[model samples]
Target: MIRVIVADDQPLVRSGLAMLLDAADDVEIVGEAADGQEAVTGAQQLQPDIVVMDVRMPVMDGVEATRRITADGFSRNPDAPVKVLVLTTYHVDHTVHEALRAGASGFLLKDTAPADLLAATRAVAAGDAWLQPAVARDLLAEFAARPDPRAPDAGLLARLTPREREVLVLVAQGRTNVEIAESLFVGEVTVKTHVGRIFMKLELRDRVHAVITAYEHGIVVPRKA
Candidate 1:
């Protein structure tokens, strides 16, 4: 089963998520926390496969809690780190970037559809990152607007094979693995292999971080609307 801890300051929101997730056959709501500190504590104690965290909370915030939980490797088994999936009421631009930097596997708006929320939890638990397309677009745009003080890491790009770099660029462009395969005239398995190599070379946690790296390093620029 995919164990989960739902953390939100509001009781109703927490309970609602628990209720929705509990209905899933492969997911279980193992615990719940009302604040960020509690979320961190619960993660350390329960070691759920994933934590559905709220971005803003009293006592502590989700970003710090995520950093502590992920950076410290505070799961039941240190080798198997717990994943955090941030939940926010607003799509506050910086919060998304900060949460990822703090080691959250992914994030979703609180008003996300019930099915999508459940799917996102499963995705994070299975070691994949999830970001809404609109959120991804906004994040890329935000990164583009900022002035990057440091130059792109040429050494990192040099480490990737040419095909791997192509895969990374498509990923940053928000293409799915299947779409990438079609674009490259390769099988999905081939695309996955290329993506894996890119991640290994770039030291990225998931596609979200890969997208961020692409934008931060100017590998891919957001398209104009």
Candidate 2:
């Protein structure tokens, strides 16, 4: 079973999320919290597989909570690692960047459909990244807004072969692994492995950071006609 902890300042939001998740047989609503601090405490106590976090919680807030959780899990090996999936109502571009930097595996609009929410939970729980297309666009805009020129990590990037470079470019373009596979006429597993190799070569924390690095390095840009 995939253990989950829900964190939101609003009690109703927490309860609603708990209800939706509890309905799934493979998912268990292990705990809930009204704020970020509580979320951290709950995570420590529950040792859940994933945290469905609200970005704008009272007290420490979701971003900080995520950072603390990830930092605590960091060692030679992360023990009972917790993956954070940030939830927010407003598409505030700046917050998305902060959340990614804070170590969230995914950014999700709170109004997301239940099916998508379930999918996000499964993806994060399964050690994969999830990016809502709308959220991805906001992240791209955040990357684009930076004043410095995008500079590729030339030394590290050269390590990737032609096919891996192609996959990274598509990833930077906000394409999901499945989408990249379809575009490249390859299996999804192949695309996933390529992404992993790219991350390892670049020393990236996760796909979110990879996307940020892609933009920072000029491997990808915000899509425009």
Candidate 3:
């Protein structure tokens, strides 16, 4: 079973998520927290497989809590290692970006259907991530409008093979790994491998950074097409 914790300041929110998740055969709502500090505490104590964390909470906040849980700590154990799924209502521009930067494995909007939400929780627990499409579009727009002032790591870009380069461009275009697989006429596993290699070669933290790198390096630009 994929054990999970729902963390949100609102009681109804947590209750609703618990309800939706409880119905899934593969998921169990092991715990719930009404604030960020409590979420962190519960995470340390319960050690659920994935944490569905709200971006805003009364104490400590999700970003800080996520940072604490996912940060490289003293011990590494399968039962207790935490993976965070940032759940939020906001998707204006940098909300999703900030969550990923804080080490969240993935993101989902609060309005997401229960099925998709459950799938997102599962995805993050299984070591995969995708910002919701709306979230991705907002982020890409912001990235294109005001390119990060800092320069891309050119050396990292130099390390990618031509094929990997093409793959990354699509990734930067906000295509999911499955989409990239279809586009490239390869299996999803192969696409994942290429993505992993790209991350390794670029020394990138995750797909979020990969997208940023692709744009900041002028490899992709905003297009209405």
Candidate 4:
């Protein structure tokens, strides 16, 4: 089972998230926390697979807690890292970006459907970044609007082969592996291999980070509406 910790300042919201996730066959609520500091403490002790974190908790914000929880696992066991799935009432622009930058694995609005929430939890626990279409669009727009975006890591980009760079661009474009394979006239396994290489070479956490890198480095700009 995928162990999870629900963390939110509001009691009802915390209970609701816990109940919603615990009902899933593959998930179990191992713990709950009323604030970000408590959430970090619970995560360290319980070592859950996922943490459903609220963005604006007292004592410490979710972003800082997320940073602390994920920081320790950076050079440790990648397979067992405690992934965070951030939930918030705010629009998916600055908040989402900040969470991701702090090592959150997935993001969703608080009003997300129960089914999508479950799916995102599962996805994050299974080592994937989950960003719904709306979130992705808003994030991309936010990045595009930056008058001076952070420059891409020159040495890292230089490490990618021409083909890997193409794969990264497609990934940033929100293309699935199947679509990328079709577009490149390659097999799905080949596309997957390319993606894996790109991640390793760029040291990206997941596709979300890849998309951010692609945008920050001017690799793939948001398309004109």
Q: What is the C-alpha lDDT of each candidate?
A: 0.83, 0.81, 0.79, 0.83
The true-versus-predicted C-alpha distance at residue 195 of model 3, in Å, is 2.0
lDDT of 1 by residue, 93-142 (tens): 57767787778888898888999999899877766668876566776777
Candidate 2 root-mean-square deviation in Å:
2.9
Q: Lowest summed lDDT over 10 consecutive residues: which window, candidate 3?
A: 72-81
lDDT of 4 by residue, 1-225 (tens): 999999999999999989998998999999999999999999988888888999898999999999898886542466688889998887644766778788888799988899999989987776666876666776776765662244347788999999999999998887878899999999999998998888888877777678878887878887665
What are the root-mean-square deviations of the candidates from the true structure over C-alphas?
2.4, 2.9, 3.0, 2.4
The model with the greatest TM-score is 4
Compared with the true structure, model 1 gives a TM-score of: 0.88
**TM-scores, in order shown?**
0.88, 0.85, 0.83, 0.89
Q: What ranking of all candidate models by TM-score puts the best one first? A: 4, 1, 2, 3
* Stretches > 4 Å off in candidate 4: 74-76, 145-152
**Per-residue C-alpha lDDT of model 3 across residues 1-225, encoded as one tens digit per residue:** 999999999999899999999899999999999998998889888878888999888878888888887777711573446888888786573655666667787788899988899888777776655568765755655666666555356777888999999999998876888899999999999999999999888766566668767866778975553
Candidate 4 lDDT for residue 208: 68
| C-alpha lDDT (0 to 100) for residue 157 of candidate 4 | 91
Misplaced by over 4 Å in model 2 are 72-80, 147-152, 174-179, 185-189
Task: Give the 10-residue window scoring lowest on summed lDDT in candidate 4.
Answer: 143-152
The most accurate candidate by lDDT is 4
